[model samples]
Target: MMDCQRCGQRNVLEIDHVLPDGTEVKFFFCHTCEEKWWDRDGVQIDLTEVLDIVRRHRE
Candidate 1:
């Protein structure tokens, strides 16, 4: 189970977000603090990083 980064709550929600450039990314949302981030290779990445990757996508 994933815990919220801000509130350290174990009640996390999974969401599918499409970036401005049309890249599909899966991230987790912390219901406690409303913290959102992507879990990649055991690391939490902010939404801005995901947007950057999406902007670089072709086709």
Candidate 2:
């Protein structure tokens, strides 16, 4: 049901990060979008850093 934020296409949906990774991050993407943008834009964030941020925010 999700659509691409850029193109508004339902065929492909991906998690897009506004920032580059230093940390584990995963985003969902449909095949078409993945093919187009994965290499150019998407980088996986570190899981530990993400968790640490979440923990700190909770505290």
Candidate 3:
């Protein structure tokens, strides 16, 4: 189990999103602090804004 970096909690959950190119992006959500981040080639990216846009444009 991965620990949440924001809250130091051990309840970090992994979320996978498949892209149009058949690639997958892995994100982590912290259940304790509600922190959201994505993994891009081993680098962590803040996904709060991106996620908001996606949800807003979805059907």
Candidate 4:
């Protein structure tokens, strides 16, 4: 059970996915605070980093 960092809520939804380039990622969404974040290889990544991943995969 993952807890929300902002609100300390345990109602965090997680989605594990693989990008087109075979990069694995985990997307986390907090129901309490409505916070969303992404993790790659167990490291938290920012939105800009996520966009970069998408662009790299598309290219």
Best model number under TM-score: 4
Query: Model 1: residues >4 Å from true position, as ranges?
Result: 15-25
Tens digit per residue, CA lDDT, model 1, 1-59? 77687898898998766766665667898888887788555666776787667667743
lDDT of 4 by residue, 5-57 (tens): 88999999999988767888999999999999989998998878878878987
Give the lDDT of residue 53 in candidate 2: 60
Q: Clashing residue pairs, candidate 2? A: 23-45, 23-46, 24-45, 24-46, 24-47
lDDT of each: 0.74, 0.49, 0.72, 0.89
Error of 3 at 40 (Å): 1.9
TM-score of candidate 1 relative to the true fold: 0.66
Instruction: Give the poorly placed runs of model 2, Cα more than 4 Å off.
Output: 1-13, 16-44
Ranking by TM-score: 4, 1, 3, 2
Worst 10 residues of 2 by lDDT: 35-44
Q: Please say which candidate is ahead in lDDT: 2 or 4.
A: 4
- Collision count for each candidate, in order: 0, 5, 0, 0
Give one digit per residue, the lDDT tens place, for model 2 in 1-59. 65555566777655544323332344556655553333223454454655566676667
Q: Itemize residue pairs with steric clashes in candidate 3.
A: none
Evaluate residue 5 in candidate 3 and report its C-alpha lDDT on the 0 to 100 scale: 76
Name the TM-score of candidate 4: 0.89
Residue-level lDDT tens digits of model 3 in 1-59: 77787889988999777644444577898988998788755666557645654666574
